[model samples]
Target: MTRRVALGVTGAASAAVMSGCGSSEAGAGGNVKQPEISSPIDMAATQDVPVGGVIKANSGDVTVMISQPAEGTFKAFSSACTHQGCTVNAQNNNIVCPCHSSNFTIEDGSVTGGPAEEPLPQYPVKVDGGRIIVG
Candidate 1:
């Protein structure tokens, strides 16, 4: 009877601990929950980004840096720096990381200067009906 009681107590404790992992918020392990984008998310309008310029935009909790390298061509990448996960800004046709002084190309998100070795993650972008769609 004592062994049965002990087993029951352990099982209850384990179940209680495991329940927190399935929470709707960020996990206790600091893992962030990415927002589900079932369809292409519209980030900005075509006129919002100028030719030969870059712009920063957000879709839900995701930050994106977009560039118009030519008259109508558009490119987009995750704004988070690969070096230390710091948010980068679009400046002077480059993605500049304020935290580590890393720079990435606006056209391809390739590292142009380091501290950072990996390129920024690229997202699929398309212009549809004067709207910029990203995913």
Candidate 2:
């Protein structure tokens, strides 16, 4: 009886650890509230990304992409794809939706494939003091 009980506890503990591995540190135990991060960003030394290019910015629970329509011009949008809210990681190519293979043009965040009808929400960004600020 003692050995069985010990094994049961061990199995339960292992299952708990395995289940918690599916989420980020803030939500390891589930119910991860969105974090509050309003600190200003310092984008000094960042190059002026021309059109057809992308720059990644990490803020809060989402990543921001700063692209441009032409040299010295810039546009910012969410890195998360609208479909299924997947993180679009392919910076060199169209923003891809991982859940359903939806594609989005980097220039305007238009849906190119999959079931997503909405584009990524634009986030305002500007260069100040030689640093890019996303607000």
Candidate 3:
């Protein structure tokens, strides 16, 4: 009876390992992937968001930060992090997430430190009529 009980426990453990592996593959197979949102971005005012500046805009379930690292150069990126799907709070010329202490530069949304393995995704934008529109 002891031998049978031990075999059942080992089998259950193996099964659990396999199940965990399967879930991991789903994240790797591009299942959590987000498609590019192509829509008319409402004209958000451009207010001298200078070098190392960050602007937070919420649209639907998304948040965006329009950054200007240098004069006359602007870059917009998804405020969300690629690691744990947490929104990056841009402050003092850097993007920070308290959840894991991930830090990214506001200049280009590039990871500067911590556990983040990938950079933030960028969004396309056009400045017209003194407003920034992201696609």
Q: Please tell me which predicted candidate would have the highest TM-score against the true structure.
A: 1
lDDT tens string, model 3, 1-102?
699999999999999966653242321221233335679575366674666687776667556778877766777876666766655676677777545677
**Cα lDDT, all candidates:** 0.78, 0.61, 0.68
- What is candidate 3's CA lDDT for residue 38? 71
Using lDDT, rank the candidates from best to worst: 1, 3, 2
For all predicted structures, in order, the TM-scores are 0.71, 0.61, 0.68
Task: Report the Cα lDDT for residue 125, model 3.
Answer: 76
Clashing pairs in 1: none
Task: Kindly list the per-residue Cα lDDT of model 1 for residues 16-116, writing each as its tens digit.
Answer: 97765433332122232323445789999999998988998887776688899889999988766787666678778788877668899887889989798
Tens digit of lDDT per residue, candidate 2, span 1-135? 699999999999999977654433321222222223366454323475545677655644545667765666666666665654555544464566554577777778788878878987765666886566766
Model 3 off-target regions past 4 Å? 1-36
Q: What TM-score would you give candidate 3 relative to the actual structure?
A: 0.68
TM match of model 2 to true structure: 0.61
Q: Per-candidate RMSD vs. true structure? A: 9.8, 6.7, 6.6
C-alpha lDDT of residue 47 in model 2 = 74
